[model samples]
Target chain A: MPRCRVRVSTWRRSVVGGAGGVEACRSGEVPYGGGRFNGQEGSEDSDSSVNRKSYPTTLRRHPSRMDQSESELKRFMSGLTLAECVGFVIIILTIVWLQYYRGGFAWSSDYKVMFNWHPLLMILSMIFLYANVMLVYRTFRHERKKKLKLVHAGLFLVIFVMAVIGLSAVFNVHNTAGTPNMYSLHSWLGICTMVLFACQWLCGLLSFLFPGVRHALRAWYLPVHTFFGMVVFILASCTVLMGLLEKAIFTLNDKTDTPYQFLPREAVVVNVMGILVALFAGLVIFLVGNPVFKRLSLPEDEMLLNEPIN
Target chain B: MPRCRVRVSTWRRSVVGGAGGVEACRSGEVPYGGGRFNGQEGSEDSDSSVNRKSYPTTLRRHPSRMDQSESELKRFMSGLTLAECVGFVIIILTIVWLQYYRGGFAWSSDYKVMFNWHPLLMILSMIFLYANVMLVYRTFRHERKKKLKLVHAGLFLVIFVMAVIGLSAVFNVHNTAGTPNMYSLHSWLGICTMVLFACQWLCGLLSFLFPGVRHALRAWYLPVHTFFGMVVFILASCTVLMGLLEKAIFTLNDKTDTPYQFLPREAVVVNVMGILVALFAGLVIFLVGNPVFKRLSLPEDEMLLNEPIN
Candidate 1:
């Protein structure tokens, strides 16, 4: 493989000097595009006079540690795979608890049964799909930024639809049954997570996906966007845990056969499912936050950095 | 203010090249010590020959942006202050919930009353105090490293003692009341948190507080220490939320007059307390994780980086 040269210009240095500079650089702000590895090096016009001046002074390729980086990349891939599996397990566990124990899902036919769909769909959309969306950039580190952005937006749209359906399931159950809505802590946090999530998604679309957003604004909003994505995901996880606890206690108390305090098999499964959701959330956050797993800046990214398209 | 000179040598570059390089540097590995600002410039012996060769190439001071950084620092301080106040509110709410609603705490007189101490003490030690301990490094960014280390360890010691007493309160209540322990999800998670907290504190004491560890090991362990620190704190928060849900349901179910589903005044207070705890934990984690609030490296840290005492 040919070596990829990295040129650190004066303008780039200045951009990296302030509070969010390093994070911006890491989040594809610094042009380290993947085009160089595809033999497209030096093809782009060096139109920026600033880049031309600092070209010779800071032109250097990192020492070839292909073997080491390869191993590390493999480790990262394995970790991602493990996170996906754990997420799948959580989804399955939820289904088992709902289908086998709580008498499977239905809509309008049985209000009690309809409530089961709430947990299942929530674990699928809010926890499972949300986590996978967070991992998409890391998973496709070499993909074009424009393509990845579209994929991200598309996936979020799907997640939003599923979340709406999940919310309706619980609300319908409560409304039809004449039970007070948003009375529990779980309901309160769940609504908060959903509201914040919708706002986050709308803001992301307007600021990032739309062409009218200014480069400066996008650069400034990137860190805030990243921070809230993690926050909303975590809040959703906590809400689900509380919901599980509420369901378990209500179910066990209403039925004398399986008390929650006795550690019934169903209770154990519910607890394990909650634990798995927390673990999955933690792993995704760690993987996303760790710099080692960050996408390597490509030569083409340098142009984007100067022009500010992404 | 004196301008501090930063010299980035080849050896330092290599150390920063690996997976954890940036984090290590941010955590005080690259030796951008604070002595220069104190008029101690060039006082240390530059015995390493590598430094001599790279001095001309990398020796440069960041463009003095004292005004920019100063305001940013103020913003960070304000954010921290808000987090602290939120944490204090969580503590106050927990006390009010326990003292006003649940009969006040006692050692062994009434098992039900004794259980009240468990939540109060755990909130004090595990949630409130733990968040403060995480903030100490950022709070005293310019303090001597040795001094900060002692303070960190001392704070952890206090936290540990309170956590132990908190654990005993619930155990005594459970044993005396003949109720099974560790049966619910909350108990399972609470025990997991306490055990992990103990292991983390002990490992921290041996590796950091003691003098025998190698520089390489300490350097490697620092990132792990920081990651697990955040993880354990989050797990603790999740556990506390579950425990609150359990208590609210059990208390409401046991007392027919105040059903949890009816959303009584006490139930609302309990739910509000849970939400406050989650918000406080989120704020603490955000303040601790944001790079903008990181402690500035000092000139004395350079020597420690080279010598490896920390």
Candidate 2:
């Protein structure tokens, strides 16, 4: 009975800590010190306020704020790790399914090989890099705001380069295959998202990072900036999803059977990749929007603001 | 010059009143009188403190609360009308595209006819009704909380009935065609969403509406309920999007041409419908998430609580 109680308490900790849900049932968290030190066990309620008031100074001899910060840290780490794993799975499944299962990728092998680079590079740039850009502020809350802005700008620049390369791959495939470019809804949406993404990056840099902009103007633009940042990210995600389904039909059109015949291994993998990518985007949006998991803005971070970059 | 100035000021009023954003640009209000009273304007900044200090009594020549409430009313009205239009458009376009362009709907004339009802009913239930469920709290914020809960419960029951009909149509079509059911990723995700939706409705009814639940327990469950409610709505939207793509390919696959050939009229309409549905979902999610546009909570809303229903 005692063993079961200990095991249950550990499971609850990791679950409440936001890392290992039922999926990661092992609930692995290396105990740093006294195993029985956390006196705030047995209560499974998720009321942060209740926990704060009841368990303060009881869980440890440390300050209540320290205990709260630790929990917040655990939540942040767990959320990011889960989101990262999902993002990586999307990339890996897309590449493996396209490369090994269909045909391997090559520089200029054929339309098929060229088409393969489209999903891989686009996912890498749009989903992975764009997600990191959204997360930079939250992840490095302790860092100087000006430094984080530079990092954010730098990451967006990388995304621009990757996006150009990815777009070229798709256009190259279209030209080689004698297929018309921007003919379908997918291509239209994809190109629009890319163009808007470029414009958004340039606009963000000019408005936020560029020197000589008055503080009042920057403050006025802040809400619009945050709104568009999220909007553009969502647009990119929508375009990617549209591209996934468009590609699925193009590659999996079994004339002998119905279209999107998921009985086939490749089709199933394609659909799974699409769902996983959508879920990853959803998780990213959730993490960014939720205040409880957001990083605490520090005094030094605020002081570092208004420092212009070249 | 005075006429032009009046027109400009009217436009500004609508804009500052939160009804002129792209998502709510129709600015449709019932106009319950007292037209030129709101004096909160010309500041051109979103600083809440400035607004509170400047136009506290000037607007409507009444209490500041009245001014804030009027703006909230405008927002609520505009948001609802816009969502209603989008929801109706989704239903109408699905019907027209499937009925007029793709040979029209029938009960058992063919599998295609049976499949037509699937999209229509599913959109009505999943997209339309589910979205309204999210908006109800915001839309009817001044209503008694018990009454709103009843309305919510009642609306969900309607969705349950519609969902049953939608599922039956798809299953019947599959059975008649002698095709396996629940095989594709679309089907898997759709079914999972439906099951979860049902469970959510039941759990919400039990915990929030039931008489036996303690106040502390109910408060503890509120956040979880709110979180899952949004999550399930998102999942449903995602499933609908997948279904749109799946159905588009199945119907638009021209053997002689590339898959999803947009030259076909039906194909173009289908793609347009998909994009519109996505935009609609995006708009709905945005309105629900934005606090500035949220409705003002009422005092009576809190008193009538924990009433059981059939």
Candidate 3:
């Protein structure tokens, strides 16, 4: 076969077919034309039980002297099992301990922030945010000019911004520079962020359903998918905010627990977020329909031995 | 062009594959996958921004002038814009109203159930069970045999059994007619469900990192991707149980709330869930790394678009 002399760097991006500096945005995931794999004709014929156990039919046979195998095994034998047993015990102990110390909900409205369980929820929020942020940062470092870089950047900006906002709220300092109600700003940015978030999901939906969108944004692969992850980050911060706010409003506990006092009154944000989430869910269902249901199962998502569909 | 006497039905089936099943599962918008023939290469790339913003775009364009262009014009006029407007309005109103109605979190000792804020959440559990059971029925409906069907059916059966146990706990009606915690049977199933969920996400992750899995699964395809989705279904159901358990303990309110009379004396379960959720969050991070602020801007992903390398 005659080989085409394509530059490694040049060919790296020859897939999506976008334009200018923004070459990453190519067609959607679906090709304008289609393909030829038909699965309908002999649909899953099987005589096995519904929950068929592993059918690891040995397809190859290699003769090995049992004596040699035993001797080699003896050479590799260590206290591996014993170590694992101890490790398992440690994990159980850790979980049990957490249940005692940092277990259940604890919130107090000693601040004007009123109803924010932010401090309490921060325990989980911090872990999630810190770990996720680190992973995202490292991925960026490794793939600098990667396909979907814009998408990755767009998502990280959102994550950092939220983290900052959450921290300030936790410490009772305004992080947005110049803003009071975080209400109006939060409402506008939240809605816009929500819209962008929807676009991110739609991009994936199109990748599987529309083709053009998939191939349009370069390979549009992982980076863009990472953008979809922005949702989880937003969720963590918001959940923490909700938890914190719960304390602020209800004064679940007073100075007896911490140093803070309640403001006037405001306890409606959680409901707003819940409504947004539910509505977003309904809209996704409407847009993607039945296919969306299958995707909703994050666990089943592993069946995707192929790249993640969305 | 030579035309062979081919069965169009078979050809279409082969071409469509999992998309056909998804099509069966979803509703398609009129444009199919949009128009404009995608323009030709070397025809000069238009500003997608301006092109996107052009008011020439209209929804519900009723073009009755003539011929094929007539349908095209009509479609152009009757496009996505206007329809989305109406949909957006409805979502806003519903969410706002729901938010207005949701009161502060309430506690209950009897573990009866709280149906206010999470009204649809509990119903979602039922819907999940309903969908699974129906799919199981469909597996056995027509073509008498299929290995994949049976395997998936086995999956559904496990879900069904768990759901039954869960429902029994909720309504106080188990087959054995036990007094309480009938749903404890579901907890054993939870481990299996979590494992399966991990498998699904792993499949998705591997599709990207492992070329063998990608090539074999055609990491590019959707059908192969949906396999992971099935596992995701069971995992999501497990969360419903968590939600219910959370609600049960919610009756206790916060530890800071009161003298602890209205609260359920059983505080152990709440603590257990918190630690479990924390551990789960940690595990999920291990599977899908965190998103945050770092050298997050990537460029490799942008190389695939076949455009000017920035």
Candidate 4:
């Protein structure tokens, strides 16, 4: 076994490879083209190599822990998108199950329908649109970088509107029911996540889109922006889980004649949704975090770097 | 701005730096000494520079985002440890509040004591020991590499034992009550996390500590090991949260006379605990993810590279 001389004084590009760096160094796995370690299989040349060349040097070197190729990663991404779609469907069905089956969703019926819209819209905004915004870079890797930014910004705007509607629905419920708002943990986290999301979106707009902010400031804020986006999304998911549990508790307590002891259909639905929601969030985070899965930076990125308005 | 001629062909040392890498590149922050960020006001040369010299060349080049001195990081760590301690105390008190006040623990009584032990021991093992196991490397960064390994392995062993006791206690409660086990989502997640923890611990022991395992295998397994450790710990915490919610729901539902429409004190306590637990997990993840906060790799790491038994 020949000692792999790792030159140490290089800059920080190495660490972003993260655990892969440690693994690569220790194993001395032939750089990129060798190991079958991280589930990398299938044809290497199915897709255009544009995305591959666009990758950061570290990613080009390490690829991923999975050593995923362009075609393989695309397949994985498609599977993930499918899983996400299914999760979305499950979330919607669960809301409908809780509302329609439980006699909560009638347009003619006043406040319950409004309350029903809270969960539906919140899931739509928080889980669905929020995930799409995060995935824009990945999904449209071939598109112009500027177009992707607009798409991201546009999606976020839609999310904000949906979130606003969701918030009003909940507030309307509290108002009509004469209950104090923000009393529950669910409400507290929900409101906090929403407020933080709004702040994050506004700052992102000012720093990235509205222009006039220094390039240095935007560069500094990018990681923070990425970090908080994931955090707020996680917080929202947890808040939703708590909300489901809270609702289940209240409903169970209200029911007088039910003889069900342990596992009911409603509880089963809730549990499955909880699992799906968690898995969905985890997968999205994984894709966002992995550089191999990132959209390729276009030539326009260089142009934007030079332009003052970008 | 002079073009920072980032040497392209250098190995992936930079990405491994992560947050520190980002900060260094963006701020071009003077290696480690010149900048006064992150409360590094006093230090010029208080500690030995052995650890500094031992850092990978990339870290030497990039150092940290905040330019936090060793003493400052140590101070930050101490503060975090204190916060962790406070959080641990809060968790214990909350359990006590729930058990003693809400009626579970009675030494004089027979079966209830067994039931009470479930929550107490689970929190002790699942949250406290699990978190400590995750933090051993970070907390004792300056310790001899061998000693840190022993500490990590030792802490995990204790966690495993505690978890076994915790599981049996829950099982005992179910057996005593003639209730079915593994029924609730809480139970399912709890059991799954425990099982995964056992597998992870065993694989870790074999791959890392056991003598016959090849270095290449250990290197490949390291990232997976680190990742699963965090994942299982998080799952355990989530399981505990779900367990608490499950218990609260059952207790609330059982009570016939209490006309509690608003958030009760018990609910508030549970919610606060949930928030604290989530925040603690988030903080630990942040600390672990930030390379600047990591304990510097020692010369012993190099020595181990040559040793066949390591």
Candidate 5:
């Protein structure tokens, strides 16, 4: 009877001990088989790698979102970055060209910095802007059926329409000089661009907030979104510069002026070419620095997510 | 040996019968104990009244939730149950007055018939618009430190300021007819309204979609939202009419045409008053709606969930 009692006591003890082990496994006090610590159980060790796998760094993690990277970047590049780079290079080239072309003919301010020739530069930058927009167009080309593709198409249409009207005004019709009903069209185009840019920015914001939604498009959609973002920046800069030229820049000769550009040509071309390189560089950095790309590049880093619902 | 065999047979019979009895109970046949079915019986039908206590009729549920007799007549009148009979009479009387008086002088077609007076409607609608906006403003009043509230305030300020400026142009500034600068301000204000409204609407949409968000502000927010929606429609009607008047009434007459009131003098005021009352009534109906009122009044309906997470 004593031997039987001893056996029962041991059996009871073992059963209780086995149940406690299962509970410990559930609470994650110590990882089963992943024993980095002394096999002594009870306390939990939460590694940074494990925690990072559970929760990610995202725009939600960003402490500040109110800052409009888009608006600020467009303003900064147009007002400062492009003018500095292109202006320096042009000024150096102009001085050299002047020295090289020492004909007895004197150059008037109009001849030296006529708004008409800047139309050529405007066309060049416009082509660059068009090219940028096209990159987005091509990336999302495969996404013919997506709802967001409508947004993409609508957005590019804004820039394209504005560009068409502005080009018509600059080269063909000289609409900016206020011939008949053209200024109305120019003004309407500006309004259209403003609306389109606002919608695009909102979409971009939604994308940033919800990473899962960043690409309902394929592997190329990131490049597409990024491309349009740059194109929009380019187009918005062009629009604002055009607005400034129409309202503020050309009248810089007044005594009331703090002086914008010395010979600030408001003729559409110079207004639009002033904000590209900086946009390109900043966009590249932002794209390259994206964590999605980092993960894509380093397949091993994504291994943390391999286990299902761990 | 015969006694042992008999005892075994009786035990087997009892086990089989017990299993059948349990299955019958589980299958919901003879549910109330099924005690006598296997023949270990009591007075089987003694107290059905005791059993009646277990199943409460649907009519005996919550008093407020019940469909009461005679009070079904009140359900046809939205929110009529809450008001005293006198209040219901007053509402009916007011509706009758509105439908009768809503015409030329009562509603002030001075603003309505002429496009110039379009601002009159805008300026008037703003009084109620301000009221509705202010009510919503109070709900977010406690959330003063939130950036979204600031955005909302900015939105209101933009709309109010633009309307004030536009109305001022219509009434106070006669120079609105000629000067490009005045038109520019009008243009700027219009653009500002478009941008501000887009932002407000998008932000409002996000707040409405996210119920668990502490500052969702949706239920209290919707009446105001609908109120603004109605106001927008009213403004659009007035503005579009004004646009037509600019082309039709003002354009046709020119500086030479004498301004003449269409209707006889006394009839004018009555018509104008009628329009205003009707507009307000319609606005109110479009906002909260009768169904919402019924739900809101219910104690368990929890329409305004205290935790803001419904």
Candidate 6:
């Protein structure tokens, strides 16, 4: 496996040569590359002493100096937690909007009901799970880089599968009802988002995961990948908002007893849901973009990551 | 008047004590704080030699090192230009959508035609003008900071006025037609965007313009201001998209001869317009958010900015 190819000797050399010096990380003292490259693949039980000893002298030198930075870190953590909570609220709102106001979900038997699955599944795949995947690196900074990559890729895969199903549900309903598909602006943008997302995932996989590229190439591509990830996420979010508006207008028009323009109960719920989705997307982007919240690379982690494995 | 209060002696002292050393910028060599705080307020003629001479030796030491960064800066410039082009295209498309597909604009004479002004003016104010206002700092990085602030505030004031007219157009139509107001999700979110935009403008004025806050408070609020600026822009974009969808559905639904679902010419044009708006917004956000494109503070500018006059 690629994980095993990371040379432990290189890490040791870098650590010994680091500012902490060889004396700081003597034999059997730092637990050999901080238990990450010690042939313990997938082991979650990392040694606490390794973490403490691996910190650079600059960080450990002034405990009082870290108070402001520590509080900033805490704010970032709380922001992330709040984003997750908002995400779940959006999910719950979507469910309630579909179940209580509109009819509940179904399969091919009921085309209208099948359309309900589209919004729920797309929100789950595109907005909620996709946001979490973007946060994995920032969230689990202490974890092994390889493990975090695995989790990121794995969540993306799940999102892709759900997105595919979501697309299928909408297409199936359109075909069954003999209605035109991909005609509206929502569908046009939605298709673009989907294609870009798939391409982003593939690029990310090739660059960072299996059959990884060279270190120089990976470094060059990393920022591009991150930039496109945010772009695709935003495109998806906009598509969803448009889709919600379209669905709300179509289903709650003048033909209905309580039309959308009348500010009916269901219309208000859908509007709130759309607003929440936008809020969630905005918060996630802010958390990712703010430099203060960025995940700092530890010395040991950097040593391991910089190894010329690829 | 506030600009005159900046102490030029402080900048001279800081420049003399800088790493380039006093020898690099002797008396009459640096042109006295690079001609910024020399009471020549609002003068557009900044000395290019002063700019070249004021650069730190670390930057000027390696000519080859400047090549890559210079190319990156060129790319950022080109990206901003491209975003501006896209924004203009969006405005033109909105005008066409309003004038050609929908009826032409009017005042109180014809409520239906008056409604047409809403989309065109909203797009002009919120999308086109707003994006350009955000790009002013990056576009005119070498300009006097106070002049840029004035330009920024001036452009925003224009946007605010246009937005007010845009809102009035819609409200006038709704009132004259005896229809409801602020009922749709589009109107709700649009109101939210307008309110937030006004508040952001006020905060910006109070913090950076007349009677400015303390430097420390301004520093703390700068990022918050920037973060909210982006959020409000995105919210505005979303609202515009929703408004487009609402109008398209309302005017081009099954009740019309060629419904929206039929992929009519108007529908396709509207869809393309919406997509262009999204692209413009995304490109603007990228141009603004990408760290590579951030406006670098000149040494002279830093000296003047760091003055404790505020």
Choose the strongest candidate by lDDT.
6
Range of the 10 consecutive residues with the lowest summed lDDT in candidate 6 chain A: A34-43
Candidate topping DockQ:
1
- What candidate 2 gets wrong by more than 4 Å, as runs, is A1-66, A254-262, A304-310, B1-69, B255-259, B304-310
Q: To one decimal place, how large is model 3's interface RMSD in Å?
A: 15.9
| Residue-wise C-alpha lDDT for candidate 6, range B71-190, written one tens digit per residue | 545676678768877887887888877888777877856998998888988888888788777777556654445666778888899899999998999899888888889877678778
Distance (Å) between predicted and true CA of A43, model 1? 20
- Over 4 Å off in model 1, which ranges? A1-60, A299-310, B1-60, B302-310
TM-score of every model? 0.81, 0.75, 0.29, 0.73, 0.23, 0.80
What is candidate 5's lDDT per residue for B1-310, written digit by digit as tens?
0000112233223223222221112111112211111111111112122222322333123233222211322332222222223223333433342234222222222332232333433433343333234233212211211332344455555555645554554443333333223222123323333444555556555554334644324433443444344334333322222232222222222334332123222223323332333234333322222111111011112232233322
Worst-scoring 10-residue span by lDDT in model 4 chain A: A34-43
**Which residue pairs clash in candidate 2?**
B99-B104, B145-B301
How good is the docking of model 2, as DockQ? 0.12
| Two-way TM-score contest, 1 vs 2, winner | 1
lDDT of all predictions:
0.64, 0.58, 0.28, 0.56, 0.30, 0.65
User: Across residues A237-291, which tens digit of lDDT does each residue of candidate 2 receive?
Assistant: 7667667766766666644564564367776787788678767876776666544
Quote the TM-score that chain A achieves in each candidate.
Answer: 0.79, 0.74, 0.25, 0.74, 0.27, 0.78
Model 2 local distance difference test score: 0.58
- Misplaced by over 4 Å in model 4 are A1-79, A92-96, A107-114, A178-180, A252-260, A305-310, B1-79, B103-114, B178-180, B252-261, B302-310
For candidate 4, give the DockQ. Answer: 0.14
Model 3: per-residue Cα lDDT over B140-160, one tens digit each: 211111222233444544644
Worst 10 residues of 1 chain B by lDDT: B34-43
> What is every candidate's C-alpha DockQ against the true complex, given to 2 decimals?
0.26, 0.12, 0.02, 0.14, 0.01, 0.25
Give the per-residue lDDT digits (tens) of candidate 4, residues B1-310: 0111222112113223322322232222212221111111111111113324323456445445334344435544664666476567656776766575566664333555666667767777777666766766556544455565666777788878877877777777777777767656566567777888889988877776675566556654665576567667767777767776666666554667442335577767766776677677666655544334444444344344225434
Q: Tell me the lDDT of model 1 at B71.
A: 49
- Residue A232 local lDDT, model 5: 44
What is the C-alpha lDDT profile of model 5 across A7-117, one tens digit per residue? 223322322322222112222121121111111111111121332342224421222321222232233334333433543443343333223321212213333233333
Worst 10 residues of 5 chain B by lDDT: B34-43
